[model samples]
Target: MRRVVQFSTGNVGRHSLAAIIGRPDLELVGVHAASDNKVGRDAAELCGLSEPTGVIATDDIDALIALQPDCVVYTALGETRPMEVIEEMAKLLAAGINVVGTSMVWLVTPRQADDWLRAPLEEACAAGNASLYVNGIDPGYSSDSAVFSALSLVTRARSVTVQEIFDYGNYDDYEYTGTAMGFGNSPDDPLPIAFQLGVITSVFGGLVRNIAAQLDVELDEVRERYEPWYTPERIECKMMTVEPGGLAAVRFAAEGVRSGEPVITVEHVNRLTSAAAPDWQVPPEGQLGVHKVIVEGEPRVEVNTLLSHPVLDVTEAGCLSTAARAVNAIDWVCRAPAGLIAADDIPPTEMIRGLMW
Candidate 1:
């Protein structure tokens, strides 16, 4: 069995730990946590596992490294001090431990312009002959897997588009509330401008470019637009400042083209309140919400029009799926050709199947 160490005690780390512990092909060797409360707790209890092992969590990276596990799964937040986490992962890799994580923003090259993020990790992997892979549900699977799956049905295409809608009511993180949808007051707040721009230039940027490259469309410029919805009244939420009827809707549009011809158009929307907008649909009775993917082109296609599963819970499945995908790719990452890789580069079905065993 391949021995693995898990980092973090957050939702993602906890759920992933459960998945890893349940897998017969893998063994949970150790657990690491930054929280003082979590240290010295049994790994199984940390994940609510019925069978508790005597393994205690530790804050020391050296302690985890000393265990000499085959791999380490880093599920810390990529937005908060992500670079520092990457450095730590690099350290583990340099010690000959394969590193799989969700901290690196650019799972593949080109998504990021600076080499500072990937350089040290690559160098460490090369030095230790270890491998690293990063993935998540949004930028990882939703865009790549869902989009690729949609493309499978279409033989010809003039353009393609993918849309994701989620109700943000259940989430209560202050950081997510302020930055994710741009709801609070801050001098830096351009409403959703920054997020919209980043989506076009970062997450879906590479996908659009890759699509154009595949279609042989030598493009010119890519443009992005943002729309914010505010209620004449106010809506009260634990995380959001919006009163009864307030501004709780944000949409980002990205358009890619070649020589002024549009090749792909993508839109992402996040709504905090169900009644925030007329077009916005609330979760049906006994349902969480819906995640839909619609592709428009010469031979139009739509796959998973409305995905209503427990996996849509950002705190639960969102983070768990991301960490699980990254962990399952540990082997491929260990043997991957030196360089960055995208979601499309990794097979989702295979990754999921591997996690199940």
Candidate 2:
């Protein structure tokens, strides 16, 4: 069993902790809590488990490193604090601990990432002879593995696109849905942080670049666009309410252009309610969320993935998928060379070891 540590206990982090504790191949050694209230709490209390695992949560970084875990499942908040997350992962890598995480979307394809984001981690990996792998649902599986696998069935591929269609009504994080996503804000107001200059490109652009690299094509440039929709009437969600004319839905895309044409694209259609954006794309059969990958070629291919949980809604199931991707990568990452490992470096789905049911 590979000794492992789970960092953070938020929505995705909680799932990571639970998975680590439940998986027989991984031994849970420590938990890192981001907030003071979470500190000292049992791993069970934090992850909604019925039993205790004896592991307590801590905010102490050095203590976790001292445990000498083979890898750390990092699911901290990276959207807003990318630099800080990078530094934290560097410290862990430099301490000789491998890391597999859902943080740092750009790191999904580190070779294509800018120097500002990739250099430090490379140096840290060299210093301690460790590795780092990052992934999630959209920027994780849907964009990379699913797309590449689908392309394998095609004769001639012209373009590739990945779309994330989500209804944020069930998402409980108000700060994320309301503020970061601009759900409850006015349509005329400046774009939300998520849509601000270069944000979408920074997050989803890696997906575009990754496709280009796999196809062995050079991108002339990466471009982004954001479109927001307003609610006709007041719409109430679990997190917050959107008044008439408030931002209720958004459609954004980051395109990887080659020779002045977009050959690869990552798009997202996010709405607070089904009725909010009638004109934009919606999940098939009125589902809450679905990830779709389309490859335009002679033998056109399309794959749609819907995640569901026994007790959780589609939004939370999405989080579970994210955690599972990182947790499942623990063993593979531990055996890889010391560097930032991309999804292409890991074995295919069938070869990876874990629960089949």
Candidate 3:
């Protein structure tokens, strides 16, 4: 069994705790919580596990590093404090501990990350002989990696498009839903993400670049597009309310074009409600969301990955899937070569730990 620890108790990290405890192949060693308030809490209680695992959550970075565990499943909030995440990741990597999770989506492809940011991690891997792998729902198995695997079926390929179409209403985080994504704001209101539109070239654009790299396609440049729709009527969610005429639906795409033609694309269709945009590609009845990869090529293949849960809604299930993505990659990442790694390099598994939810 691989000895492992978790970072943060957020949605992703909480689900990861359940996964790590339930898996017989993994041993829970420690957990890194965000604050002193969470310190000394049983890891099981933190994530609502049925039994205690003896491991406790702490905010002590030096103490956790002293243990020299195999890897740290980093699920902390990177957007809020990116520099802190990078610095901590560097600390862990330099301590000779492998790292994995959803902190930086752009790091999935090293080239997509800024040279200065990427340099320290590469140096850490070399110094400690440890590895780092980044994976999650949108930037993970559900996107570029999925598209890459489908290419093997085609004898000759033309173009590839990967999309994430989901209802954001299921997610109840007030800050994320309202502020970050521009939900419940007027159409003209500035969106945190839209203002940093060039940032797409690093996140989703990394997925596009990964696809192009594997297919051996030369993309002259990657482009970004953002389109939002306003709600025709007032809508209510668990966290916030969207008045009529407020932003309701958003379609963002990062395209990898070769010779003026889009050959690889990563797009997202997010909505507060299914009715927010009747004309757009909405979910089917009772379905939470759809992640698809369409290949406009010789075989013309397409993959629709639809996730639904009996207890949790779509967004929660997306969290579960993202957690699963990181948890499942733990073992593979530990055994992979040292340095920053890509999700595509990890082996694919159809069913992991029976997928509790």
Candidate 4:
């Protein structure tokens, strides 16, 4: 069994930690939390597990490292000085401990960025002969596996477009409101628009570019558009914004030019409200959401798939499955060729199997 140390106790963090605790191949050696409220709490209880383990959460990184864990699973958010978290991961790697993280934008495509961000981590991992892999459900699976799955049916395709539509009102994270979904704000607010722009351009930019290259399309321009609106009346929800909902709908469309013409269009959207167009049907109950992939070519076809469970509730079985994907990738990530890797480079079937077991 591989000794593992987990950092953070947030939504994703808690789920990942639970997976680590249950996996026979993995032994949960330590748990770390930045928050004092959670410190000294049982790991299993914190994760809502039935049995209580003696392990108490700590904020001391050095103490956790002193346990000499073989790997560290870092799930801290990117907003809280994410670079610093990456730097610490580098330190752990340099100490000969393999690292797996979902903390930053690196999971999408680390190589695409300027070396200033990617180089140091690479150097540290090499020095310690350790490895790092980062991944998550949305950018990790939906954007890659779901898209690739769609591409399998097409014999010839001029372009591929993938779109995910879901209500953000279900998410339990409060930070998601103003920062991610733009709660309690007017449709014209620049903050929401800016947030959407940064997300699409930063996370999915590489996915779009990679798809273009796979299809042999030369990309000229990639753009993101945002549309936000407020409901004239209020809607009440336990986790989301107040009644009179604030909806921030964003469309991230990228145009890939081949032969001086737009050949490929990739787009994704996030809707903050429950209102769908009059012509469109509302999503069924317990439905996290739907994914549509359209191939534009001769006898153009569109395929729609649904995830039985949405990831809004971290404690749900579906959420565990998603989190386990990232967790099971740890060993492969440790053995992966140095540098940034994309999901297309990794096999999802194998990842899913490993996680399910």
Candidate 5:
């Protein structure tokens, strides 16, 4: 059995903790808590488990390294703090601990990452002979694994598009939804970080490039486009409130352009509610979210991936899937070579470990 340490107890981290404890092939060793309130708390309490695993959350990285687990499931936020997250993972890699994480979405296609961001981790992995694999739902499997798999069904391929359509009403992080995403802000105001220059490309562009590489196509450029929707009435989400005329929905797309056409595209449709954007894509059957891959060619292929949980809500289940995405890859990453790894690096398999009951 592989011993594991879970890092963070935030939206995604809590689920990672629970997943580690529940997996029979994995042993819950320690948890790295980021907040003072979470430190010293039982791992079970942090993840809503009834029984304690005899593991407590700690803030010390050194302490977690001392435990020397086979792998660390890291779910800390890396969108805003890329450098710090890189350094943190570098430290873990240098300590000889393998890591599978959902943070640092740009690292999903490690080769596309800027040299400065990729170099440190590579050096650390070589130094300790460890591997680092980063993945999540959208940037993780939706665009890379799911897209390529669907293409195999088609006799001839033309162009491919991967989309993430979600209602953000259940996403409770106000700082992210309200401010960083500009959800409750006026459309006339300056665009938020979500649409700022190079942000979408930095996060999702790698998927486009990775797809191009997979198909042996060269992209002349990658272009980005953003569209915003204003709420016709007040809509109150769990985290923030959207007034009339405030930004309610956003559609962002990044396309890999060849001579004159887009060969690969990654798109995101995020809304505060399904009613926010009647013209744009919304979740199917009024559900919370769905990841879609559309391949336009001789034999058209459209695959939709919906994730739901019995006890958790849509947003929580989404976070759970993000955690599961990394946790499922633990065994594969443990045996991989020492370096940054991507979805294409490992063989494509379902890797579902949960019991049917």
Candidate 6:
């Protein structure tokens, strides 16, 4: 079993912890916790496992690196503190620990990442001879790999469009749902999601560039757009509450232009509830969320993935799937050559899914 450690037990990170324990080939060796409440707790206790693994959670970075784990599932938050995450990733990689997680979106395409950050990562990987791969459900298998796989079945590919339609009312975090996404703020409040156009461009831009590389086409520019919806009335869920005339839906889109024509695109239609943006894309019946990929080419092919389980709702299934994407690929990433890797470099899905939960 490959020695593995869970880094930060938050939304998706907690799922990574479960996935690490579920896999027969992976041995849970350590748990990294940032919250004071989580520190000093048993790994199993944090994850609600049947028995303790004799491993305790710690906030000491030195201690984690000293473990010399084969792989670290670094699922700590990076959206608001991206630089810190990147710096920590470099440290882990340089210490010879292969890393995988859903940290930064630019990591989806390492080549086009910011020079200052990407250069350090490259240096660290080269020094320690370790590898890193980062991805999530939407920017990951649900979109990039799925859309690219569809393109293989066609003769001539034209354009690609991937979409995620979700309702965040069931999401656990209120800060993210209310403030970061503008779920409870007034419709007129300036959304942080809208102001980060450059960041969005870099993240989805990588997906577009990867597609262009596969088709041997040059991309001219990448673009991002955001549009939000106003709540028609008061709404409440298990997580947060939205008042009338407050922000309810946020629609964001990114495009890759080639020869003045858009070739690759990713869109997210997020809602607080089904009634929030009825006109916006909604998943099929019985599904909490859906990821749709449409390739407009010869015999346009479209693929729709419904992320919902018998017990778990769409958000839960989606989060688990995202965690599984990186956790399942742990062995593949660890055994691969040292350096930044992408979906194209990964082995087949059947080979990567060594042990399913």
Per-model lDDT: 0.68, 0.89, 0.81, 0.66, 0.88, 0.82
lDDT of 5 at 155: 89
Order the numbered candidates by TM-score, best leading.
Answer: 5, 2, 6, 3, 4, 1
lDDT of 4 at 248: 36
Give candidate 4's TM-score.
Answer: 0.86
How many pairs in model 2 have backbone atoms within 3 A of each other, for residues 3 or more apart or on separate chains, i.e. clashes? 0
Local accuracy of candidate 4 as per-residue lDDT tens digits, 1-357: 778888887777888998888887888989998887998988998888988777889998889989998788887776447578768878888887887766675456555655766788888878888877776665556556666667777777777777665555555665743466566666555665335545656656766676666666667766555445556566555455544545534444555566666555556554445552212333445554555677776547677655544433422443454566568877676667655556666765557544456
lDDT of 2 by residue, 1-357 (tens): 999999998989999898888888889999999898999999999999989889999999999999999999999988778789988999999999999999878888888789988999999999999999998887789988888888998999999989999998889888755688888788568878998999888878877887887898888999999998888899988877888988889899999998888889899999987878978888998589899999999799999999987899999999999998899988888888899988888877622677753
Across 1-357, the per-residue lDDT of candidate 5 in tens digits comes to: 899999998999998888888878899999998889999999999999999878998999999999999999989988888888989999999999999999988889998888988999999999989999998888888987889889999988889999999888878898755688898888679989988999888888988998999898999999998999999899987867889999988999999998889889999999987778989877788588999999999799999999888888888888988888899999889988999998888876635644332
Q: Native-vs-model 2 lDDT?
A: 0.89
The local lDDT score (0 to 100) that residue 357 gets in candidate 4 is 63
Off by over 4 Å in 1: 108-113, 184-200, 244-246, 280-288, 305-315, 335-339, 347-349, 352-357
What are the per-residue Cα lDDT tens digits for candidate 6 across 87-145? Answer: 89999999999999888777877776779768888898998999998888878875568
Q: Arrange candidates, best lDDT first.
A: 2, 5, 6, 3, 1, 4
Score candidate 1 by lDDT: 0.68
Model 6: residues with Cα > 4 Å off, grouped in runs: 349-353
lDDT of 3 at 348: 62
lDDT of 3: 0.81
Tens digits of per-residue lDDT for model 3 on 170-282?
68776754577777778566665643658666668878877777777888999998887888899887657889998888888899998898888898888876778879986
Q: What is the C-alpha RMSD of each candidate to the true structure, in Å?
A: 3.3, 1.5, 2.3, 3.2, 1.5, 1.8
Which of the two candidates, 1 or 3, achieves a greater lDDT against the reference?
3
| CA lDDT, candidate 3, residue 5 | 88
**For each candidate, how many residue pairs have backbone atoms clashing (under 3 Å)?**
10, 0, 0, 5, 0, 0
Query: Each prediction's TM-score against the native?
Result: 0.85, 0.96, 0.93, 0.86, 0.97, 0.94
- Over 4 Å off in model 2, which ranges? 349-351
TM-score of 5: 0.97
